[model samples]
Target: MSGYAYVTAEGLKKLRAEVEQLERIERPSISRQIGEAIDKGDLSENAEYDAAKEAQGLLEAKISRLRGILANSRIIDETKIDTSKVQMMNKVTIKNQKNGAVMTYTLVSETEADFKQGKLSINTPIAKGLMGKLVGDVVEIQVPNGLIPFEIVDISL
Candidate 1:
């Protein structure tokens, strides 16, 4: 499916760094492996050559995919995002209706999502349901288990 990829400044930086590493370090390392494998003798029986070829293929695939992602990425301005409404880059606090449990999550781009840090991807079910919701609004989200109701308690940058 074709869709826009949103990314934060930090996420963009990380992507650039990764691309640089692949070009500067990983590319050369993999090339060296291939060269050494070629020097080892027969290609049909050389396991090292086969493995190196596989590794090079995987690395090239990764590099291509990442480049595509970067090309389509749109960097989000955290400060300019609308806090008045639930949107990308907004830190939203919600309360579960069933258990009265409160949770805080920053709605971010797919690349920026780090669940351990409470940063959720905008593509997530919960985040999709939460988008455009206002504070004090009760949002009902559909999940595998069923529908979950949550009240938007707060929103910030």
Candidate 2:
């Protein structure tokens, strides 16, 4: 069975905005760069031409992947979420059972997870272990370091 991609409405909107930006600005800019490089003459030894071509290919691939994600995106309705249990779109606060350190993370889709922003992907080891668990329950999660125990302190929208 294929896993569902749980994304927030704002995250989906951002993806759409990025698609528009690539179509309107980035694609044209790359095309212009390629054209200018081509005008510089020798295609065989032109480093600029080669670089531009590579960039264009990478850009197209990125655009394609983004479009695919947008096509498959399921925007999560945050308002309808049940705050009784840990689920997608839940802001969960967990405390390390061993160390007594607490960290709060918002479980989100892979596309919506920004580690820098404290959002963890639903597919991640920690999030997967926490899913469906209730508050006050300790779940053992396997990280690269090894399995560690974390107690679910709270769950909220």
Candidate 3:
């Protein structure tokens, strides 16, 4: 929350779009709902009004959080990324030493991580262990289950 979050230009654009949607569209819609609910009945007996107020609060909190993230975000230039070793935004191919299973993952910021797309958050234990490691290097990382060793196969931008 304090330090800068590294994000790609596309990720930053997505975040900005989300914030805009929440503020420009969702906020006014919630306000209209609150106004309609207020017209329904007494303050103490109105469930709709209460629900609308709660929803407004939650939406405001989300907007605040997203704004904070944007304030601290730093966009990473893809052209400046180094592929010599494991690093943020690098697509890394690794093999599980114990089972010989190979997998590839792109190390990315937490907001940009999509497991379905094979993007791993840099904060994850595996990505943390892989940081700064070169291809052919063997690394042992501790996970919830136990320690597992992985051999770095390749690194690419």
Candidate 4:
């Protein structure tokens, strides 16, 4: 899981911004909380000190994880993407053959996957099934409910 994470320029920028926010704002805030906790005497049974320490540990771990992702990330040029077939960063429109339901999703890297925004992770079952598939290609994908067939309606940038 420590391999390179290919991301769009915007995705990379967002990641960097999140990291900066955690480091510059969150880190100092946690430090201040710990310091204020220390101002209160008797650290042995201090709930505020314990809570602050726990929060700091969680934040540091999160920062470390994000840094690791950033270290291994590579920006993917959106202009170089192909539309002939399904691939990373491509917006794909698919139709469910069984239920005739049409849905569109933008296949993206793991870090940028947000289903609510129609961004899907390439590692997902639907995305995996759609990889390298051309428009009008029908693919049978195994989903949580059961196996469902989907036809590639369109592929775009």
Candidate 5:
């Protein structure tokens, strides 16, 4: 995708929803907690007020980070994805040369990655190694565990 971060419509929707939830729901909840802590009196020694302030800071930071990701990443057209070579939004199946273990992952932007759902970030070593490789092409990826060879079994939408 021309060295740009690409996110799917679903991912974009999720990010937007999260921002909404944070701003509308979580923000109000935290504000209420802070108000309650203040109403309890003695602000200088109030643990609840300090905890609420810390949580507010963390939540604001997270919201800002998520918004930045939303602003920087371009939404991908899923239907136009090419399977000619491994790239973003492509579901790729690979087989380990040494252990014979097969794994499938959909390459996506870092913001959209959910390893539990087989979404692998393009920034990862394995995804970087398979970036432009075609089916049947073997690639050696250097992960934290060390270099391991993998054969591209299939690439699909």
Candidate 6:
């Protein structure tokens, strides 16, 4: 959680691709914008130049941050994942005790989480509460609104 970001091979590849796109495409585009602004002259009050420089700085910072994340990332081996209990990378099906609504979510690293895709970050309150819980276990998770009870229906890889 502090020093390393656990991710799947596909997640790692996606992160790497984002970094490449930033460096190869965005960097050059920002440089071109800056050059064009410079050719327009008047350095004392050049809003375009200033904006382009700021954008470049932000892009560089993003690239650096992403590289650091990549450096500290550890890919999780899917083959070794145990499905006996709830844990990272496990697809868990839970039923809302109050409304009887059923939902399935895959527990994944923070970097790989996409709510729309049914991928929940392990850091989330629900995931944290479900961690290490076996199928048929009931858990109560505290969210911003209140505490909600859920029954573990199934857990799989």
Report lDDT per candidate. 0.91, 0.90, 0.96, 0.96, 0.93, 0.96
Q: Candidate 1 on 1-157: residue-level lDDT in tens?
A: 2677899888999988898899899989989998999998899999998998899999999898888889998888777888889999999999999889999999988878999999999999999999999999999999887899999999997
Pairs in steric clash, model 3:
none
Deviation (Å) of 150 in candidate 2: 0.6
Instruction: Tell me the tens digit of each residue's lDDT in model 3 across 35-56.
Output: 9998887989899899999999
* Residue lDDT tens for model 5, 43-84: 999999999999999999999888788777788888888999
Candidate 1 ranges with C-alpha deviation above 4 Å: none
> Cα lDDT of model 4 overall?
0.96
* Pairs that clash in candidate 4: none
The TM-scores, one per candidate, come to 0.89, 0.94, 0.94, 0.94, 0.93, 0.93
Tens digit of lDDT per residue, candidate 6, span 57-151? 99999999889989999999999999899999999999999889999999999889999999999999999999999999999999887998999
lDDT of 3: 0.96
Q: Any residue pairs clashing in model 2, and if so which?
A: none
In candidate 4, position 35 carries an lDDT of: 97
Q: What are the per-residue Cα lDDT tens digits for candidate 4 across 24-104? A: 999999999999999998999999999999999999999999899999999998889999999999999999999999999
Count of backbone collisions in candidate 2: 0
Q: What clash count goes with each model?
A: 0, 0, 0, 0, 0, 0
Write down the RMSD of all candidates, one decimal each.
1.7, 1.6, 1.2, 1.2, 2.2, 1.4
Overall local distance difference test of candidate 1: 0.91
Best by lDDT, which number? 3
| Model 6 stretches astray by more than 4 angstroms | none
Q: How many backbone clashes does candidate 1 have?
A: 0
Report the candidate with higher TM-score, 2 versus 5: 2
lDDT at 38, model 5: 100
